[model samples]
Target chain A: MNVAALGAAELRNRLHGDGLVYRVGPYAVRLRSSIDQVLSAFSCLYADYPVEPDDGFADFHVYVHRPQNLRRWYRPQAIFEFDGKVPFKPLPFSQSYPFFEWGLNWCVSNHISNHLIIHSAVLENRGQAVVMPGNPGVGKSTLCAALMLRGWRLLTDELGMLSVDDCLFAPVPRPVSLKNNSIDLIANFAPEAVIGPRCEDTVKGTVAHVRAPADSVARAAEKATPRLVVLPQYVEGANAQLIPLSRPEAAMQIAGNTFNYSRLGLQGFATLTRMIDGCRCFEFRYSRLDDAIDTFEQLLVGGEG
Target chain B: MNSGTHRWSVLPDTVLHWYCADDETLVYYEQAGTTHLLTATSAEALRFLEYNEANIGELVAVVSQTLTLDVDGDDEFFFLMEALVEQLQKLGLIEACAH
Candidate 1:
């Protein structure tokens, strides 16, 4: 059953008690929290995710709790605990949901070694996936959200999980975090997009999350062969264009973006080389989402220029 | 300058992983954990140096013959080969033999 099927009281009970175990893409997460904001965020953002049975093993056990000190009465704060250990400093109590999302991303990127995780947003179109690798505030998430609204299936909004053996991208579809001005930008761009509550202040400025489409969450197990690697730059007022990149240049750029390339050693080199061999690479610069979408659509039909 | 006295050889214990596609070659140096893209001439020079260590003049002569360039008459070709050797040495891919 999906999380939406449960009544509010039951859902709250599950979260406050033994935790609500749910399947999120390739991993099962057990989330425990007494914070009302976190519960509200999960109820809205994760309503479509499947609720796993208690017997199944959870890949991550996470908790959001208020500190017990008198500071709770003065200035309340929320701490994120993973497997009973705190990995981050306490954030303001209002920032619980954003902290949960960031903490979960941290868990997957740091713990999962089987797949080569890259700090990129991945999406699929016509059975072909495009991996968009970029640094923070580069509009990677904004572009990803725009594409998803434009009928592209969201594979992931943060992690580009590439299988080590097959070089296929494993789907880890989750809420797309929109930071600062992009939150309002996406709201205006895709008026129909479902966005959760905004967590103001804290790190990364004000942050909000856009829920992944129900179709993407349903097809979580499906993987896609990466056919293109685009390093995107969202320059203001710049004309939208795709510049073809040499295989060697693309390979080196992808290696630099990968989280575990050095940790995986020679195996990482082999996997990346194989991916670069099959995909057309590009450096995409754009300011307009519509123009970017048109260019990418033409690319799919006509192949790289 | 005695061509027979100088030799060029790849650094010992350095591992290189190569990926060649459509006239482009990428070499990954295992020791440094760095990947580099090579021009056709540079790729050919490295491939030649992998098996045989040759002096600058000898390398220039052999590479000129392999690439079908007449370095004997072309000053640009001669300097290109000289610069290529220096570049490879700076990258730690090859070392000059001590006299």
Candidate 2:
């Protein structure tokens, strides 16, 4: 029997590239990169999502395929391809690349009503999603990696896709990228966590990815309510702290941090305003992962009372 | 050069708002957020907001005349007011009263 006969959840969707194949959740993705690049991008970046060894068809079936033509030309990003045509561009910069992570962001956002995609990381536990939104190098990935290891279910390390209808956020749990000292820090902090090999000399400094929790990966499709909207910053400080921010302030920050806020234009502004009004906003600063985790647990456990 | 009861500081350009207190003021926009406080200029700008809706051309004329400064060569006065007003508009503090 061929690999297709094995029954993969992602068979419904198919993507084709040079010689590699990708099974993005329920979709298939193909890339035109060498085996090394393909493996490095997916295997290393998202080690926790898990990939079944190929029976005899091709390399590991990937859900996301960053094309070779765009890889050299554009930023390191992921894409999700769908069976039917989409009204929006799949990649952040469609003109420069064509790749999508098989997390079904496009499908869910397209099908689900009242939910708009917000650029941030989402972690759900006990029906509550903690939204961490910020620009690059704000310690979001590091904090997310530490949270996943400590017990919070990893929703997504990037792209905190928020729903407008139910006021909930769905997890897109990709890989938690650790830069420079982060890899070592997590290794020493949580020895049990499975981390991918480190790739040296990238733009964001020497980088490696830490795997998400198995349970989170299993329930990747699940969506949770957004409780707190945090703008976390990894400052060299003595104590982890959370500072309250007003709705307008939060709105501006959330708007600034959004992936397609400007792209969404007026709709984006309205969605952002609604999101800020619905969720509590704060500025979090931390040095120790454990300290940060404790603070988050307190917030999540306390609920929005 | 003080002209009509223009409320030089009480103009419409001050329509947008962020965080304001006794001495500190914070302004937010799509581009970035800025904070202003008790400075003479900010006070004057805040006063300008009273007019409901005004642009740089009007604001420049008012400030230059009120301060008795050379209205023609002071690009700094015009430039600062224009940028601040743009940010104020972006923050929704002031809507385009023009149309």
Candidate 3:
């Protein structure tokens, strides 16, 4: 792969004095570091598409080699880089960050969309996709990771691209970001799961990326009409519970949670209405991952009550 | 204050609720807080919201003379006006003027 032939090296830098340049999409981005760092980030996120050259003008190109560079690049509306830092507040250390590169990819991809990009997990069973959209500590990712391990096809462990018009969810299928106890929990719960190295002292405590099941990666582009849009809040020592949500409530919730819902204007509204009409909305509270997975599986097998 | 005072600028003749704000345009719904994206025709009706309390008789005259109504004579035109008005009222964009 001739790197120069693909994209014009836009930005250049040297990491630890290593001459490194990144071909962003179609444009070659020059940076200061080993391409290994960039490749590592790409691997963490599971970006299978080829390094497209001179893809033309991008929204922005940035480089992250130092720890403090994390704070500097935080404001990109849409970000694309790999750095070890925790995005969640009350910064959890002791545990290393898993999949910093994957996390960065998720941010950039989600930001590019003219829809609300949520930090949630999405998975599909049967033909319909179940999207769990919410904040970082919601256990949405854990549940998403577990289900994917248990034969549910993973669409995304972090972002769900939902079109309001057809109400269909396009698959992102990135690596699942598991933190602290989640890393161990999944390892113990499903020994077959592929858990990555942990990066310490960032946000959300110690973090790691769990590689998506191979079947999911193969079918990463599968699109499904969202059968359900759920907001899950996980609590320790509590039983799993699924609460019903009305169409109006769902619409409002999605609108509020959507990253760029208001940005797409009429198109966004139309798409959102279509999504709300097509799917059932719910608010779930669960403590145990297996129980949550079972309840969702049951709903998929039978019509929801 | 007066619901009928201001009609949604984007939605012309049909009923509308100025429900959402977008980057460039505003989202006007045919019903208040409802899910339906106002069809073009319904959006056209939103133009009538610009008028301050125009009655069905006035609207029919305007819609008919200014554009195509697809209806027969004055009676049918009046019926269409009434229906449009009813939808507008449902959307909370217009009210029947005391006059």
Q: Which candidate number would show the highest TM-score if scored against the true structure?
A: 1
Q: Lowest-scoring 10 consecutive residues by lDDT in candidate 2 chain B?
A: B1-10
TM-score of 1: 0.93
Candidate 3, A180-283: lDDT as tens digits: 88889999989987766666655456777887665675564567767777888888788888888765556666666666655665666667666666677789
DockQ, every prediction: 0.55, 0.06, 0.04
Each candidate's lDDT (Cα)? 0.87, 0.58, 0.57
Q: Of 1 and 2, which scores higher on TM-score?
A: 1
Tell me the interface RMSD of model 2, in angstroms.
6.8
Better of 1 and 3 by lDDT: 1
Query: Residue by residue across A38-77, what tens digits does model 1's lDDT show?
Result: 9999999999999999667999999999989975767889
- Per residue, candidate 2 scores C-alpha lDDT tens digits across A1-305 of 22234233232222233323533232233333332343444443443443333332432223344445765356644433344333333343321121333234444434433446655777877777778888888888888888888888887776667665555665566567678888899999999987766556544566666766757766766777777788899998658999987656666666666555555544555555555555777899999999998899888777755
Best-matching candidate per DockQ? 1
lDDT of 1 at A73: 67
Off by over 4 Å in 3: A1-63, A66-118, A164-166, A303-305, B1-99
Worst 10 residues of 3 chain A by lDDT: A88-97
Note the clash tally of each candidate.
0, 33, 44
